[model samples]
Target: MDDTEPVRAEDGCRLWTDDTGHGKPLILCHGGPGLWDMFGAVATVLSARMRVIRWDQRGCGRSERREAEDRELAVLQWSADFADPATARGYAEQLADPWFGINYECNAAITAEERQVWRETELVTACRGLAVPTLIVDGAQDIRPRWAVDSLQEALPSATRVVLPHAGHVPWLEAPDEFRTAVVNFLCPA
Candidate 1:
């Protein structure tokens, strides 16, 4: 069974959430301050054995869109060689969809806030307190540096990191079978 609902935040923002299946709960958060829950396939597979909850971040996806101060930043363009051409093209097409509208203001604000938090907080120390098992999956060819993810995995006591060699930023899109297998093995060890 799949159920979707709007959850109100303390600040009164309505976040869109979908909950499915029936065992231990696993929340799937999409990447990007601008992206929504695009984990339908992952949810479907995992939901058979566990409750899967997917939610759009504030000001993103199906959540309530809010207007904020304009903060413009130059967009970074990747070279053609950055990722596999076909995979890159597929991602571009996905982004062109109306449902994939980019929320620049939300991205900028959240990015700025994240920078501040990173600078102000002892992230490693904070992560050390989190005892829950964590799966840190990364694409070996992602444009973003992997050191940060490596550090996170090192800090968390129960964290397991999986690096998919044949993928880029969005591993599931490029290597669906491998991605599904890795996630399933981690979430439902046999």
Candidate 2:
């Protein structure tokens, strides 16, 4: 059974969410300052044995689309991150659509808060104490630096890191088979 609904946030934003299947609950979060849940296929397969829930971030996807106060900053950041001219051009074309509806304010605020947390928290130290097994799947071509992820993997005793080649920010979109294999191997190691 599939159930889609609007989950109202504490800030009064209605986030779009879809819940399906029925066993162990698994919440799949999309990664992005301006992206929606694109795990329909993944969810469908997992739903056979586990409950899968997917939600769009506030001001993204089917959720509320709030106006961004500064589009130039977002554009500049996007361009700077995708340093490769061809990649930047492709991203620029994608962002040209009104449907992108990026929430620059939300992105900025979240980034600021993340920076503050990184400054104040000893994440590496905390990871050292975590006994849980962690699988860090990273896209080789992700704009974000890989050093941070490398550091986390170094810190965690049972952490396994898999970098998918030819995949950018979203590995599943570009390397679905490899991504699936990595995750399945991690979850059902033989």
After best superposition, candidate 2 residue 41: deviation in angstroms? 56
> CA shift at 44, candidate 2, in angstroms?
62
Q: Write the per-residue lDDT of candidate 2 for residues 76-167, one digit (tens) a residue.
A: 45554343545664564455545455665999999999888875248777888999999998877778878877887899999998998777
lDDT tens per residue, model 1, 68-165: 20111111232221358755765644444434445769999999998888752487788889999999877888878788788888899999988899
Where is model 1 more than 4 Å wrong at Cα? Answer: 1-82
TM-score per prediction, in order, is 0.54, 0.47
Clashing pairs in 2: none
Query: Global CA lDDT of candidate 1, please?
Result: 0.76
Candidate with best lDDT: 2
Whole-structure CA lDDT of model 2:
0.77
